[model samples]
Target: MIEIFTVDAFATNPFKGNPACVCLSFMNDEHSDDFDQLFQKIAKEMNLSETAFITKSSTSTSTYFLQWFTPKNEVPLCGHATLSTAHILFDQHLSQSNELIFETKHVGQLKVRKLKENFLELDFPQGQPQPILLSETIVEELKQKLCIKSDIKGN
Candidate 1:
């Protein structure tokens, strides 16, 4: 049976910060279409912003294969969810090493290290932001809604 956990990341207390559902799967076999469907189903049921699926790497003791899914679709990367996954692993003593590596399909390897004072550090590649053009009317609307008195800029 797969183990599941709901963890709150970036929170000092329960019910605060972002909550993510983490599913721990023991199956080391290659994922099939059915597996993808099942993960999506579970994410939908959880109804969270993102759900993380983690499996032990077949080659490394400290490495795991990780995937993130929203209620509707799969995403390439999610920081809060990744942190939640690492928190679960470290909290449950699932990893023998203090440093753990997570391999993602799109983002390559993400390294997470446990720190003092029950903190965890994650190192991942930075995302490149794409510029989007916005009309002046839309920008004005946004400024008004956000109660900004100064000019707003949007590419």
Candidate 2:
């Protein structure tokens, strides 16, 4: 049977932080397609933002393979779900190592370290946003909504 942990991470309150379904694999793993379907079904059942599945050796020597799924679809990387998975592992004493490595579709190598018993440190890359120039029509709409007039004219 697959071992699963439902964990709340990143916040003290149960409902405030993200809720994640963490599953650890053992012998005779589920098929890829079945597992994907399982994730989709469980995610839909939980109706959470994301759920994570992690698998590793008993010694934790092998890298942990992680997959994240949203209620609607699969996501490349989910920070909160990853943190929740790590938290569950750490709490269970399964992860004795100070640092936990996660390989994801988006984040190639994710490092999650334990700062304290309840605190975890996650290191990931930042997503940069591109600048968009607003058109005069959009600006006018904003002004009308906010009741503020701009002195600049349309180019």
Over 1-155, each residue of candidate 2 has an lDDT whose tens digit, in order, gives 55767777767877667677876652124225456787777777767778787655233453476788888898989888888878876776545777787766666778889898888999976778886778889878777888886675443
* TM-score of predicted structure 1: 0.83
Q: Give the TM-scores of the predictions, in the order they appear.
A: 0.83, 0.72
Worst 10 residues of 2 by lDDT: 25-34
Which segments of model 1 are wrong by more than 4 Å? 27-34, 141-155
Candidate 1, 1-155: lDDT as tens digits: 66778888899888999999998764355534457788998899989999999766775866888999999999999999998988887777654568888988899999999886568899978889998899888888999999998977766
For each candidate, the alpha-carbon lDDT, in order, equals: 0.84, 0.72
Report the Cα lDDT for candidate 1: 0.84
Task: State each model's C-alpha RMSD to the native.
Answer: 2.8, 4.4
Q: Candidate 2, overall lDDT?
A: 0.72
- C-alpha positional error of residue 86 in candidate 1 after TM-score superposition, expressed in Å: 0.7
